[model samples]
Target: MNGMTDAIALALAAVLMAGAPLVLATLGETLTEKAGIINLSLDGSILLAAMAAFAVSATFDSPWLGVAAGMAVGAAMAGALGVIGIYLGQSQLAVGFILTLLARDLAYFLGHGFSRQPGPDLGVWTIPGLGEVALIGPVFGPIFGSRSPVVHLSLAAIFLCWWWMYRTEGGIRLRAVGESPRAAFGRGIRVRLVRLCYCLAGGALVGMAGAAYSLAVKPGWGRPQGCEGAGWIVLAIVIFGGWHPVRAALGAFFFAALQVSGIYLQDIFPSIPAPVFQVAPFPMMILTLLAANLGRAGRVQDMIRRHPFLKRLSQGWSIDPPAALGQDFDPRKGL
Candidate 1:
């Protein structure tokens, strides 16, 4: 019985740890895409944040400070994307993909030298008295009957994103801008500024999420092990969430569960190809995109009809991205 309790605790921790990165990045992506600007650069943004956070934490010898530095870099990266898409009028998807390449290489170069260096790992903080229990050890216990601090933070973020995306006046205007930029502009919303702000804010959160990967999830920073494919999983989560914060959060949990379970399964079945879990989110992404397409089949089919190659593909699956995903909205287009 005691052994079973311990196993369950370890499994729970593993699950939460695996899902932590996804939760952070996907939640942030949900907010950004909700604004109609898909950040293809989150791959890069997260990498940059990981390196910067690790380096800064090492330099300052403070995990908290390091987390802050990481978030700043992430936000800065998103701001760059905003400048290109909002001011320079480049392709959002293209530019984002380009930056992902840039971010990866940059992180590689910078992180190479620091691979073996030591940095502080974030320890779990629990309540005082409750941490002392018979069956519950320090790593797993009643501890005032709660989970890791990051879990609480993630929950708070879910509500915050929901409020900002739905309840607030600003959120309404943001949705308006995303659905139809020209209409949003006509309604006296400063479309460019609003979008830019959303991009930067989203980027900042992504950076923190990436930092969480190293600072919390992985706990120790190394080049290969940190921020591995997390950015894309986050993108899938946004699509899975239908650009809603709460739903996207659930998507994060689902992906996270698969991830933790995948890791656990390794002990039980080492022969199973690791790539299966690594690649699981992508297929799930396709499914979500198809589902969203089903919601807007008319427009999706029309677009597919316009594209010779896509028309055949559309017959098999739903094909919508989001209400306004990935399209460069020009006021002149009047959409």
Candidate 2:
């Protein structure tokens, strides 16, 4: 490959690798939201899971075991949130936020000894026949390669989630619960139970995202960790993606591209402050959120739709959060 082509190829590969974690986390959050629950503790969940995955893998010398441990931790944390916030009638947002802080500290403290230590990782795997293809091999090969099977897993997750949320009978019920729990309840669906189930399941996926970071993307754990605020960014990608699994995956890829862009730019502009590139995605995402939500009002949306340029720019930018999202439900009370 030519220099430019190679640079582009590597950049895209980096995107798939970096975005894998966000893809998992975004999908997890999307599933929870689809069931009318918000897993705000995702930020901490990722941190704790990463620590658990790395620490356990280092100790046991088994990456798969570490992944299992990470998923268990994530599921347990999310289950606690469901039982307390959903069943006990506490604020899910408050509980989730507190959990993030606590998990962050716990990961740091408990994982102190494991920092900077080497651990098991999914090394690269080139396809037997396909890896020989001149063009396709280099681009698609790395995604499914053993170095990071999470890329393939993330794609599978997106497909499965999209199918589950739209193509099946159970999916319709899931949406009904989020859109209108009362309506779902009237149809004999257990709203609270569905929400709790999805919440726990979503947390498990988020936990796996953490393991993907340690075992596949970054390898091991240490200070100055880049995984700390990734959960928040993943959450933003969910909103930026309009809560659709596929769109959210695209958003994750886009965000990862931006991160890669910062690195690419550093080579051309070495004088620029490094932190500027690091933090650029944040404001960009905030602006994207503004663009999306600003057109939600009736008149504004209608006006934007009528103008060619404005309509084009505002395409797919509107707010449609689940109808009964975050609202406590009582099946016996009829709402």
Model 1, runs deviating above 4 Å: 1-9, 128-148, 271-322, 329-335
**True-structure Cα RMSD, model 2:** 2.1
lDDT of each: 0.75, 0.86
Candidate 2 C-alpha lDDT tens digits along 180-249? 8988898899989999999999999999999988889889899766887899988888888887889989
Looking at model 1, report the run of 10 residues with the lowest lDDT sum: 313-322
Give all TM-scores, in the order shown. Answer: 0.81, 0.93
Give the per-residue lDDT digits (tens) of candidate 1, residues 117-227. 878856676556554656555545632245555665676788888887778998897787778777778887887888888888888889988788778877666658556
Off by over 4 Å in 2: 133-147, 297-299, 307-318
* Colliding residue pairs in candidate 2: 123-147, 124-147, 125-146
TM-score of 1: 0.81
